[model samples]
Target: MSGDFDTIRDASSSDEVQLVRLLEEKIKSLQIEIENLRKELNYYKAEMEKMLSPPLIEAVVLDVLPDGRVLVRSSSGPNLVVNVASHIDQKLIKPGVSVALNQRGSTILEVLPQKEDPIVKTMEIVEKPNVTYSEIGGLEEQIKELREVVELPLKKPEIFREIGVEPPKGVLLYGPPGTGKTMLAKAVATESNAVFIHVVASEFAQKFVGEGARIVRELFEMAKRKAPSIIFIDEIDAIGAKRIDIGTSGEREIQRTLMQLLAELDGFNPLDNVKIIAATNRIDILDPALLRPGRFDRIIEVPLPDFRGRTEIFNIYLKKMKIEDNINLELLSQLSEGFSGADIKNVCVEAAYMAIRDGRNKVTMKDLVDAITKINVKRNNMESMKERREKYS
Candidate 1:
């Protein structure tokens, strides 16, 4: 019995030794595999980092936009923008060109290729009809005031500068609806040789999400680029109105856009040659900040046309139409008291229509009177009045 027990123990000990050796070999193989995997992973990680960290090369502009933005192509067959200043001298740019980029990894246009024929863009200036001081009568006082704000800015920059003053950052034209505030803005831009960016405040009031804010920023930046620019916002009361505590989401967004505009104007250096002029029938609703001294520094009343202004406006429109000798502009102007510039224009159009319907070649006083009566009736219509009131109120 002792011999059998000893033999069994010996056999068991040998089997245990063999099993331990096998397990050790398996562990070693697993370690080898893990080490190999680790090496491969490290290699892949290094390759990925190298690909992502490749240096970006500066590219030269192949072309530019009308706004003077550069469009360039990258070596990787992707298009990119070079950070060349819009004011960079055009003579410096040539095709197959290369430029050193600023530290921002943006390229500056440097070399131009001789073989490349680049596209040259020319700007065409369309002149709006002149609204001379003579064209606007009876508002000599208002015209004189506007001339100081509009005409003097360009005419007397040196005098203004010597006094350590810049032109008004903004001007608000407000009064009865259709009083030619918009027309005046156009005329101001025309007279000043300034670029004009026209926007309606209501457009900002209904924008999608962050678009309004982005558009506002872009507009200011664009205005900066186009220095001596006029940014005219019509219906200014819609977006510039003072905010209330119970604001809707849309209203809040509009307020944010307006606040951004205010900030941009506040930070603006008047030397940049940008001015803001807004027109609204209701200035009472605009934010007080918009009317502050350095911002909307000047508030001009574009009131209903007075008798003489109306007469001049009448002649201006009448001169364009076939009118009978019997048509008296003085009488028409006197009769259209409390009418706006737009109202006068419409009356002329309506009178012409009446004359045409009557198979007449020239518009006469009877046609004018009939048109005026119809216009009055339409103005007195409850629905139309309600709409106008809602618009301005």
Candidate 2:
């Protein structure tokens, strides 16, 4: 009996110890869970506080008073006298500086750093174009001129400085549509290793008043910030057309945009390392102020490819295609008179399509001829329709 009682007591004592250890582990687990929940609760509280805060308004300091008061022009409301926060930097509270205002817009909260306008940010081209000079078959002289005017100034500025001449600020490429004007700009972007900003001139002609001019200003400011940059404005005639006093709001707005462009071109702010390239199909309609000596500096005309140029272009386009030995590129070039580089490329593409349709493995001379014939017929029909429309209108 005594031995059995002792065994039972020992078993009960061991079970009590195990139970105590299990309870302690449970308490530790609960404590850890409480800590995590507290952390989550704090995060939620912080988020709620942020959500409840009033939104601040952007304002510009028009003038600074000797006292703590400032003349601020709120972005949404009229000018008002506001008091600057005591902790805000007084130096940055000067005129023309941006600042955040309180919910009431009666107190300056903090000075804001100047930011690149959103319009300019959208116009920046982050990727370099894949076009190279070798891919451009025609316009050797124009390419050479471009190199001397653009590449030389950028790659070897010492030559220009040594010769005691200011490097050219911009280049103007005028040609018919699809004649490789934009491609040349792309080649420049590829070659110079510069920040290329491609913007269509029409984009600057906004419907709202003052927006167009603002965009132009911001664009130039951005180009300045990203120095050693290239600004390629395609279809420049849209904004650079000759100004007229017709009194229409649209015309007036375009004139304002043009004025801003002129100012940016030769304004008090020097272009320095920034270069401009503009393309247009209608050079005659462009404003003379934009084409004048210092603004464009070099105006190279990109004409249609001549016979030799056409032959070279054909060879370039044909390089990737399997062709018969009897294919006469020279004859095709002769037949494609007045065809632009783009037109030749189209002809080649159409020829390949023809071969595929005929279940042929290679583009033959017959396919090439057929493609040229079909394209010419289509062009003639379009021209006839245009003539009829013009005559009737």
Best by TM-score: 2
Candidate 2 has an lDDT of: 0.82
Q: Can you write out model 1's per-residue Cα lDDT over 162-185, one digit (the tens) per residue? A: 888777878888898877776677
The lDDT values for all models are: 0.72, 0.82
TM-score of 1: 0.68
- Return the TM-score for each candidate structure: 0.68, 0.70
Judged by lDDT against the true structure, how good is candidate 1? 0.72
Model 1 CA lDDT for position 39: 100
- Screening candidate 1 with a backbone cut-off below 3 angstroms (N, C-alpha, C), the clashing residue pairs are 94-112, 94-113, 95-113, 228-273
Instruction: Provide the lDDT at 280 for model 2.
Output: 93
- How does residue 292 of candidate 1 score in lDDT? 84
